[model samples]
Target chain A: MVKLINADEAVSLFKSGQSLMIGGFLSCGTPDMVIDRLVQTALKDFTLIANDTTTPDCNRGKLISAHKIKKAIVTHIGTNPETIAQMNNGEIEVDLVPQGTLAERIRAGGAGLGGILTPVGVGTDAAQNKEIIRIDDRDYLLEKPLKADIALIYATYGDAYGNLAYDGTTRNFNVLMPLAADTTIVEVENFSDTPLDPNQVIVPGIFVDYMIVRNKHG
Target chain B: MDKDKIQEIIARRVAREFHDRDVITLGIGLPTKSIQYIPHDIQVNILSENGIFGVGSYQTEENYDPHIINAGGVGVTIKAGGCFIDSFMSFSMIRGGHIDVTVLGALQVDQEGNLANWCIPGKFTPGMGGAMDLVVGTKKLIIAMEHTAKGAPKILKKCTLPLTVAQKVNMIVTEKGVFEVTPQGLCLREISPYSSLEDIKQTTEADFITDLK
Candidate 1:
């Protein structure tokens, strides 16, 4: 069953320098409250796996603004001006991944797959001799998977059963990441007592460890 | 050289053949023009990965509001009965291959259906953003670009540069022609009357064969 907790307690699970996977694409599906709690925590030396930190004050971007992230293995960071500033100033290290490959790596991490094959950035720096595999005498790139100690995700709603439903874009990372992390926490708009319909839960209860409640529509 | 020509090309390509009720994703930059081309009566769902589905008209600037944004990180308009959700899940839709047709712009297209729209001459273009995910995950993909930039061909025999995605370019629509890449080779379907085979070949040193359709 899921339990509700305050933002501070939820964010406390994350410590500085820890390898974390923060789920959300941009603003949608972001664990804003958890990220907000981290703003004042003054943590650093963290390795982050994300698509992009949410917009300032919206999602995990608050963490970036607070200088909490030391490095990011992500697809894009253009929206987070602070992230850009930190990277340009050498305060943070950014490993840009192909969007699909990054998602696959996360999925692989969850599924116990060590690596995957792809055709993104084969001749570019994105493939700096990581590994080259050939099929039909044509080249494809081998990409390694990534995992996290903790994964924080957002969903539209959940039940006491810990089933997850993403409202919109918020489902981006929430769908596949819970299984990829050692611990996955959910922040849902509505937390109810009724068990969700089996088909309605974007994420099943088995992968979730905790749930936080919020009112998104109200 | 003419605004009318650019608009015509942009319009025709955006409304390409596809399932009538599939979900569509549009990339940023020139590909943005595609929004203007979609027919109003079409029932297809136009989604902005930022967070909005059932996105509305792009022509009326008044229709755009700050709260409605697409995955490209730009403001957009939402249609009636639209619901705003979170963007994190929007990306989940992409990662899970829920997208139907994803149209994007390219910098270079090589003989083997590869694309290099993110960088050139060692200078970075806006990195891969959501493109790799959209291309690999979308059911089908298309690339649109100017035939050449600065009089040099953007299409080449081999992308002698960094690429955003490889072998993901299923079709190429330049101002000059519409070409479909297949197991056979670069097969041409249309060419602007103003340009010739020599004109395209002269733009880049890529090998070419004519399959005029």
Candidate 2:
């Protein structure tokens, strides 16, 4: 069984200067209630790993706007002007990885792999300071896996066993994030008393540490 | 020319490049506009790196669903055969050479076929979303942009900005003309009726071989 907590308790698990893997692609599958609670906290200097920082007033962008993130390892920050401003001002460190590389790195981290060699970033600035390995006369950049202290994810439905099911494009990063963190916490929009259908279970119960049900007041 | 006219010309020209059954991905901004100009009879499957395949037209307020969005974060609808995918599978399709063609907007393209669109160092450092992966893996890579930037040539002998992918651009479509990137050099394949060869030469910084009369 998975431990069910409130939004406050969920945010309480976060610490200042810890790394977080947020599941979302521009706020589509993001944990809104948990992020809302996190925004009200005094936690600062967090390292955020996600796809993008959404818009200025949305999802992870709220953290960027609130000056909570010290470093952001993301694929794109073009949608969030606050992130861009912070990066330009040197207020925060931004490590921009290619989207595919970012996904593969997270997948590698989750799968217990040391790293992946990809041809995506080869011969570009992304290959800078990275090891170039050659096989079959083709060069590939050795990209290291990326793991986080905690994973904050959202799902359309979850059961007492923590089996998660996502909807539509919202499943983008949510499916890969749960296995890539030390503690995986999910904010479920709907809770099922019984176990979810085995076929519909995207992330199994073993990977989830806790879950918070979305309430009307939350 | 005005912005709308430039977009129309480039978009219309780029739409002609597509064939039926082509699985294509369009980058944000002007490249997305090409969908409106695709031939009515041709059927192309669209892919969005946000984990959607067979993407269709954008959704209106009445049909808007927050759960469905394109790579640009705009609400969109899916085609009949469309299906959703996870991020890992989406990138797998992109990096594993399944996509047919990719149309992208660029800040700069050069005679050497190097593309620079993702960053500008201290100025515009919006990360390379999936461009690096798309350019390297796609069967065809087409860059669609204006002929010049504020009266300065965007097509150059060599890209001054950081490259998105080195020597990977296959074709370039501009309001002025269409140029194909070959091992020999940039070749002016076709010139728009509105622009003269001299006009192209005056606005372009890169040397090109053209048979336009």
Candidate 3:
């Protein structure tokens, strides 16, 4: 069973300089209430692994604007001007990975695989500092698995057991982040009184550690 | 030509590349505009890297769902029978060579079919989103863009910017002309009605083999 907590208690689980995998594609599936609460906290210097930092006034970008993120491992940052500015000013370090490669690396981490071999970045700058292996005369860059101390995800519906169901494209990184982290906290919009049907559950209860039932106004 | 007309020319030309039931992925910006030009009779499955497999047209204000968005973060409608996927599954379909064609706007394309569109070093360093994966995995890679940038040729002998992928581009549809990238080099296939052979020759820095009518 997963314990249901408030947003304030969720904020207390973090420490400085921790690596967090945030689930979202430019704020669509982001844990808004948790992120909002985290922004008010004194925590800083977090390493964020997400698809994008989003915009300045939105979700993960708020963490960047608050100067809480020391480094970001993401696929895109063009939508967030603050992240670009921070990267340029040396305030935050950004490692730009290909979106597909980023997803596969997280999957590899959760699945306990060594790493992934991909031909996507073979001839590009993304291959820099990475090991290359050749098979059948084709070169592939070896991207290592990425694990995080915590994962912050969002779900449209969650049961007491923490079985979650995401809506639409909001399931982007949310499905993968929970598996790649030691502690997975989901900010749920609607809580069901009964256990959710197994057919409807996108994320099983075993992967979820905690749940934050959002306030009515939040 | 006017900016709208230039975009129309490129979009219309790129739209002709699609066939019925072809699974295509369109990059953000001008490539997305090509959706409007796709033939009505031909139904294609649009892939959005954000996790939807059968992406439909853009949504209006009334039908806008914040959760239903394309890779560019714009609200969009999903086609009938479209299914939602996770990031891992979405990329698996992309990197696994299931996508038939991918149309992307480019900053530079060299004669040797090298594509440079992701970064400009210090000026523009937006990360390579899924372009590197799409270009290598798609069955056909098409580049849709203007012929020049502020009168400067984007088609060059060598790409000054970093490459998204090397020697992967199959076709290029520009406002001025259509080009096929071959092992021998760039071959000009069709010239746009608004532009002449001399105009293309003058605006392009890369040498191309063409017998345009």
Ranking by DockQ: 3, 2, 1
DockQ for every model comes to: 0.33, 0.84, 0.88
Model 3's DockQ score: 0.88
Question: What's the TM-score of each model vs. the native?
Answer: 0.77, 0.98, 0.98
Question: What is the i-RMS of every prediction?
Answer: 4.2, 0.8, 0.7
lDDT of 2 at B205: 97
Task: For residues A1-218, write the lDDT of model 2, one tens digit per residue.
Answer: 99999888888899999999998899688898888888898899999999999998998999999999999999999888899999988999999999999999999999999999999888789999999999899899999999999999989999999999988799998989889999999999889889999998999989999899988426
Question: Model 3: share of native contacts present?
Answer: 0.85
Residue-level error in angstroms, candidate 2, position B4: 0.7
Model 2 TM-score, all chains together: 0.98
Q: Could you tell me the lDDT of residue A167 within candidate 2?
A: 82
> Over the true interface residues, superposed, what is the Cα RMSD of model 2?
0.8
Off by over 4 Å in 2: none
Candidate 2 clashes between residue pairs 3 or more apart in a chain or in different chains? none
lDDT tens per residue, model 1, A1-218: 76667776687788788888888767745776777667777777788888876565667777777788888888877667777777778898888887667777888888999888776566567888689999888667888878898898877789888888765445666777888898887888778788888887778888988788865321
